[model samples]
Target: MSGGVDSSVAALLLKRAGYDVVGVFMRNWTEPDAAGRCSAEEDFADVRRVAEAIGIPYYAVNLEAAYREKVFAYFLEEYRRGRTPNPDVMCNREIKFGDFIEEALKLGADFVAMGHYARVRREGGRVLLLRGVDAAKDQSYFLHQLSQAQLSRALFPIGALTKAEVRRIAREAGLATADKKDSTGICFIGERDFRQFLKTFLPAQPGEIVNVDDGRVLGRHEGLMYYTHGQRHGLGIGGGFGPGPWFVAEKDLVHNRLYVAAGRDHPALFATALLAEDVRWIAGAPPDRVFRATAKFRYRQPDRPVEVEVLDERRAFVRFEAPERAITPGQSVVFYDGEICLGGGVIDRVRRPYFEARRSAFGDVFDRVLL
Candidate 1:
């Protein structure tokens, strides 16, 4: 259980169905806050209260060592390489469904359960991962890296319930987390300053912020890791303001410099195609030839039509029908056929034919910029 209303209600629903429900709170990451406090302790207490109230056997397991080695190490490596990686996907794979399931089975669990807002379908001995009934709250995007084996042993008890309905059920059950605010950002450091938290691990290296169009130096940034592609806010830039404030257009990680564009619709922010590596298809390998499908480059983005070609079992080349903005590397690009999620892989590179030439001659040539 996450000490949240979702997990608590999941356990309750299973209990009502006459199944042997056991609440397991897996303490995965224990990164200390700036105040030296670990928030996992607070969550543990909440889980205990809900598990007791529901009259089910509750237990806690410390998976800190495993999480640090498996999930956290990968998270830091991605940032070091100037790529944004989603640690939640790694946590779900290596820790939750991986280690947690092994732990749960040792405790005699028939099936592992989570509060994820996604569903699983079994037909003709083929298991399919489907979007939850609550489209607004559908989390199949995050779980897109899951394998067939993981989905086979997994259960999402609250996939059919809307967020409002889940909250109402919690209130009716008098759960402690009925009104608990939804957690956002990384679980280890909740609501803390993102850049400041990242600096704790990734050393801050000062870099120049260059305007992408004119190649003019705007200002200095604390570190490239603190900024992301196409981000408009948090940049302390001044002057040269034409269309609006500057946005992060790219990161010259090799030179330790950041690139900015003046307008939101700047061409520097869009890409025609992207390359992804480590593709894992839940159903199995997709057809080797080029195929049309829908994909989401980021979690909040809507699925858009794309042409996908399976370069290999672990990689693919994707061309979006429409130009995609802020296609950052190291983020997962999940594929889908209608409501059925077909796994995904981490983005490796974005192909920009127009920018590729300009990016090479950026620093020296100023007047040649288009906009």
Candidate 2:
């Protein structure tokens, strides 16, 4: 539940619906702070308090080994290949719905539920994934990697309400987490300096920042893994030749150089069509070979029109009808039909303007669940 208002209300709703709800606070990893204490103690305590208030069975599960093997290792491997990996997506697939769901089922629970802002429905014995009613807080993007079996056993009680409504319901129920601040940054990592946390596991190779067009040195970057596709601030690059703020145009890992250009509209970074790998469709498969749908290349982005093509059983690609800015590698491209989730893949290649190709080696990582 993450000890948040959303999950607390989810438990309340399920309890009111006559379902035997057990509140679980999953401990994915032990991230100790500068004081040598696990940072998750506060959230865990809050979740426990909410569970006590709700009068349900509450327990904490340690999945640190699973998280390290599945998500953290993959994160380090992706960054080693010069790509930004979404650890949250991997956490959902490997920890929450994967290990936690199995644990819940093993404990004789009928179903596993969470505070995710997405919905799952059964139509004619086929399971379908749908977006949350609260569009602004929808989290189906992080859930694209769920397998058919996991989606069938999953429940999302907060899918019907907005964030504000969730808070209200929690307040009405007298839950302690009603006013709790939302957890931000990497799921297990919390709000620590991102690059600093990553440095512990990744080898830091200092590199140079240069202008994309002229190849002139602008500044020095800590490493290629320290930056992402569309980052603007904390670049430490001096600005003089631009009218507006500059954005990272490209990361040339081969030469260990970063390329910056003026503004987010830099032609070299925007892409019309994106090639995604490791695609998953929650509705079994796409209804048609070439179907029009709404696709998002990053989390918190509005869906855009696109045509999806199944390249193979394990790989697929989507071509956006309009150019997408910062269609970055390592980020997931989740597809949707109205509010229903159509599935998506990791963005492998973003086609740059004028035929320059930005490529990566970690283009197709997927489904590494331990048997």
TM-scores for every predicted model: 0.95, 0.92
Best by lDDT: 1
Q: Candidate 1, residues 1-371: lDDT per residue as tens digits?
A: 98988898899899989999999998887777777778788888999999889899899999989998998899899999888889988888889989999999999998998998999999877778899889888888888888888888999999989989999999999999899988788877765777888888989999898877877777899898888888888888865556667888878776788988878888888888988888888887674468888998988688899999998879898998988888888789999999899888998888765577675576533222111
Can you write out model 2's per-residue Cα lDDT over 1-371, one digit (the tens) per residue? 77888888999899999998888888877777645667578889998899889889888888889999999899999899788888888899888989988888888988888999998998888778888888889999999888889988989999988999999899888999998888777765665677788888887999888777666787888998888877898788665665537688777676787877777787766777767877777876776887888888887888799988887876776777887787788889998888888788887876665333322321222112000
For candidate 2, the per-residue lDDT at 243 reads 53
Clashing pairs in 1: none
Flag regions of model 1 displaced more than 4 Å.
357-360, 363-371
The residue pairs that clash in candidate 2, if any, are none
Model 2: per-residue Cα lDDT at residue 137: 91
lDDT of each: 0.85, 0.80
Q: What is the C-alpha RMSD of each candidate to the true structure, in Å?
A: 3.2, 4.6
